[model samples]
Target: MNIRTAAVRILNSYHHQYFNYENKIAATSDGLKLSGKDRDFLYILVKGVILHRSYLDFVIEIAAQRSVKKFENTVLNLLRVGVFQYLILETPPHAFTNETVDAARQLKKPRAIGLINAVLRHLLLKDELKTRLAELPDNESLAIQFSHPQWMIDRWIEHFGIANTQIIADFNNSYQKIYFRHNPVKISWDDLSQILKDSGYTISVAIDSPILFFSTDTPGELIRSELFNKGFMSVQDISQSLAVRLLNPQPGEVIIDACAAPGGKTGMIAQLGGRESIVNAYDISPAKVQLLKNEAFRLGLDFVNYGVADARSGTFPMADKVLLDVPCSGTGVMARRADLRWNRTPQDLETLLVMQREILTNMVNAVKPGGVVIYSTCSIEPEENWQNIEWFLEANPDFTIESADNFVEAKWCDKNGAVQVLPHLHNETGGFAVRLQRR
Candidate 1:
């Protein structure tokens, strides 16, 4: 399939997922057939529009002098894709407009093609688009400029101040890094590096951890490689790897990963703990539990056991350590998960706060006295990060905060003893983790 048609198909898939509450990644993977460069272009067009949807719509509103809702959904999404390409991708206006107009005809909206062409042309004729972006007010402009919900931006400003919020917005609007963890158990880092290099893959060290490696190869190619099939490498984000490092699981100890799914960290624990330690990994979803089991089997991490149970309600035997990697608003990793900025709302944050509190409380009880409980989330929001830790500390007198910097880098941790990995600061996906010891 051509890039434009593939983009449109993926955009329609995003529309269905957006309206029906579906997974955008799963939808894109299932719907699009383009591969390699074409697939990359399709991803750029589709995710760029979604990440900058409001911004693209704002440009259209400025050029067309009307609300975007006035157009049919297909036409609107087509316009969004066009505007994103022209304004953000900085594609040549004539080529972008004409190509979009041609693609618009595929939507069977022949009558709307002229409007799409005219509006995009008008935007093109305007001298340098950046000049127009400078004209709007602060909050309203940022809401559209960054394509983030206004309330989220406001909340970030309240917690992080104006400059940091803008930095965060910039981070969220950009493409994210792809990091892979080499399984030292199956193959040494030197061997993995040689294999990836020989396979025409470029490697870089973005973090201090030797297990983590950054690559230029697409995730699809990496997953299908012999190394991946033989369980020598696994796709994981650096922020998550950092969390596992902070957990500091030791050999011969028992660790319970309360929210383990797909089992990235479970494998990490088992690998790091050598052959002596045991990991009882559980997730609320049985399907996800099965995925963890499969991952464990593939990685040859038999030390990592799996079960399906809700951490908030299920009772489990006490362990030397417990990892409560709870769900959150996922604001920190927006650069990778583009639709999350649109899908998350203020109410969702509030709901997640309650769930985080409940899960933390339950998981803390499962850890033995003097044992560690590492609470983690892929969220930059304080309400879900340090704020939740504060609440947990106040409620659970027996648990005291540990210096997260000691585990990772002291620079990432705040005075409250929790680490907040800001994407703008780290130049990677954002995440948060705080270690606590039971008194």
Candidate 2:
């Protein structure tokens, strides 16, 4: 496809804020028809725009002499992609404007060409995008600096300090690293590393324990290589690897991976504890259950029983250990899911946190006496992580703090008793986890 067509496709895929890296790339032709160069450039262009979107909007809203809130969503997203390249990625000024103008025209937005042309020239001549950004009033500055909605900034400011709100936003603005766990039960680190390297994967050191960072644009399907298919490893975040490890499933125990799909964590429990521990994994979505089934099949593990059941309203056989990697605002994963920043809101977290708390309560009830419950999220917000766990503990004093001293950095003191991982600081997906033991 031409540059204009690519831009148009990207614009059409962006659901204002509900977009994700997967969604943006899902419809693209992955077959051999598209040249490798075209495919590679497509990823770079899409990701570059997605990563720098907030700042790009700040520039567009400035040049237009209008409130960003008033702009058409499609026009705004398309222009943001254009301006992002011309400004941040340093695409040629002529090509940037011409391609984007053509894209706008193709979208039945013939009139927007002038607007797109004017903004690109203004940016190229003045190059004041940064200077203009520096002049935003405190409120607007906070919004842009963090790359979050002003409303979210205010909500975060009300909760965490202004400094912390700024920190949170900055965390959301970058591309996230790749993290996956070494399923020691299947293959040792030494063998796994060799298998990956021999197969042409670039490995980077992230943490000394349990996780490995391998960079490849090879579709996730490549992970199904002979090594991975032989139950050697599974792809998962560093925090999630830690969460399941901390759950510490032992042989002969039954564990329930609530909301388990894609089977990353579930696969770990099976591989970690061996054939003695039977894992009954549940996900509300059938699609996710299939993901679990695929992962289990790939891992060559027969210990995991996959099922589609809503943890919120469904009953299941009792489990000795329960892991609820519940859904939340996904603030912690914005770097990987670059399109999520625009999709999330303070309201969403509020609603999701309530469900998270309820899920925690259910998991607590689900586990047998003396069993453990590890509650986790790919979200960094206190509402989703700390407060919900705090409420769970407050209601069930029978559960006592099980030391999360095994956390990557072990700094839960200020986090109200949960492992809170941040991106700007940790260089991994932002996440949180709390482990509780029934006394």
Candidate 3:
């Protein structure tokens, strides 16, 4: 499809969130043979639009002679995409306007093209929306100006204050640093750093741990190099490695990675605990199990055994240590998963709590009475992190809290035996973890 056609279809599919940020931009630009300028410009346009959506809607409300939301998704998103290019991205009116209008026409909605043109042209002339935003309260101003929801802004302001909230908001609208973990068994960071350097990617340390971030002028697929292929490295975040650290799989102990998939932690467990100890990684999906097994081999960790089993269902082998990095609301990963911000609701917490509690109760049984159950998530929400643990502690008399601060540095932990790593609060990605010992 043409550029304009794709723009219209993107909104229509309602799957734009998965593709919203930069994840799919490379493929999109490649498929379209987009010019370097146009590709960069569109990435800015699309991301800016999603990031500042609420603010843009307010602007549209003020600028349009009539309601803009009354229009079809295609026409509405076109206005957003178009207005985003002109206002935030500073993409020239001629290019952004002509392209968006052409996109509307390509969608077989020439009538909608006139509507898109009319709304954007109105925005260009009136200057009323910008003026109104300037006259509003601080949070309101940031909300409309930045296109974020007011409640979200208020929550951040309450927790982190205005300036840090803005910084975190701005950071979310940018590209994530691509990070990789060196397989401890096969290669050292010093050696892999040299290998990555020769391939045009510069690696930056995430922490004293094995993780490293890189920005590549060369494409990222270059990881197919000998170092990566030989199980010398795997991609992961700084805090992500911490959960495995907490599990501390000994050389001869039995460990289970509940909900392991794409097996970053499973292979890591295999790496640390050594291969012969039987790191049985379990997930409900067989395909996910295969992924765990694949990473095990790639990382040169042979002890990891893969099983398609659900933790909540309690249908797995017992173990000395259990790493339950359960499925979460995914709120902590807003920067990496843009669509998640809009997709999650407060009600999902109830459903998530049921699943979490069920899994915790059933899975803890698989842990030996004296062993540890390490509960973790790539999440910062208390309901999904601490509160659930509180409930679990109250119910499971045999379990006691083992403060995560005991193992990892207490620099970024909460007092209640859990850690909330916000994007603005830590150098690592947003996440939470807790260690519980069965009494």
Candidate 4:
């Protein structure tokens, strides 16, 4: 399939809010039988437009002499894809113009052909796509230049300061290297390293982390190999692995993984908790529970058990250690989930804050008096991390913050015994994990 058709299908799915953006893209690609290169280009076009929709529209309004809101959804998306290719990809001027026009005709958008051509002609004459967008105000510049929401940029500026916020914004706008953790229970790092190397994979060890990273090109080869099927390696961000490290599950200890889905942390718990340790994992989704069961079987985690259960609704069995990786705003993982910046809204943060409080309270209740509770989220929002911890501590005087520096690197832990991994500073997914002990 051509990039234009695939991008349009993805945009239609995204605009309708019918299904997940990335999942829809994968399904569309598979349905169209796209080649590897065409699939990559389709992803680039779709994500590039979504990631930079605001900025692209700002440029489009300048060239079209009208607000993009006035155009129909199909025309607007076509313009976005066309402008993204012409300006950002820097495709040959004439070739891109002709290709986009042909795409519109092929899609049976004859009524929009003249308007598309006129806009492209005007954009070519204006030549503003290459200009440095420096003249605008700080808020406007950050929004249009980086294609992020103004409210989010302002919040980051307040939290990280002006210069560092820009650095983080730029990082979120780019692709991050894929990180993987070698399953120590299945295979040692040295052994896995040699195996991957022999399989024509380029591998590098992460600094200050036991994790490994490799080129993204060979994922197809790795996914189909015995290493993945047998769970010799697990794909996760280094910051996420820190949660399992901080939990420090000991031999024969009982661990409860609340809200566990896809079972990365649950598997890590089984590995770290020793062969005799017991791990009970729970998720709200029945489908996710099945996935957890599959992961456990693949990794040979005999001690780990999983079921579908909601953490907020009922009491859970008391355990020596509990991990509550609660869902949050996902501000920390924008690099990998490119469309997240557009999907999130302030209202969603409000809903998540309520859910996080409930889940943390329940998990804390489930842990034994002296046992540890690890509260974590893949979010940089203070309301979801430190502030939530503060609220929990204030409400429950029996629990106190445990120094996380004992397990994670001192640099990743704050003075309050919380780990806040910033993407710009750490060059990984943004994350926050704090350990609490019930007195």
C-alpha root-mean-square deviation, candidate 4: 2.5
Error of 4 at 76 (Å): 2.1
Residues 1-439 of candidate 1: C-alpha lDDT, one tens digit per residue: 4467557765766653344222443455456644555655766787788889888888888778898878777788888888888878899888888778878777677898888877887886556456777776787677777889999989888887888888899988987767777788888778878888888877786564635656554665677567788898788887777778889988999999999986888888888887898879999999898889888878888767788899988898799999888988888888877788888878898898888888987777788988999999988887888788888888889888888878887877767777778876777788999888998
Encode model 3's per-residue lDDT on 150-243: one tens digit a residue. 6667877886789977777776666677666666688776787787787667555656543343444432454535656787777776667788
Candidate 2 lowest-lDDT run of ten: 407-416
**TM, every model:** 0.92, 0.85, 0.83, 0.91
Alpha-carbon RMSD, each predicted model: 2.5, 3.5, 3.8, 2.5
Off by over 4 Å in 2: 16-21, 24-26, 35-37, 64-78, 98-115, 127-135, 183-188, 208-233, 406-417
**Total backbone clashes of candidate 2, pairs 3 or more residues apart or in separate chains:** 0
Q: How many collisions per candidate? A: 0, 0, 4, 0
The prediction achieving the highest lDDT against the true structure is 4
> Clash pairs of candidate 3?
4-103, 52-147, 55-147, 275-303
Q: Residue pairs in steric clash, candidate 2?
A: none
Best by TM-score: 1
Q: State in Å the error of residue 436, model 1.
A: 0.9
Model 4: per-residue Cα lDDT at residue 246: 93
- C-alpha lDDT score of every prediction, in listed order: 0.80, 0.72, 0.73, 0.82
Q: For candidate 1, give the lDDT of residue 5.
A: 58
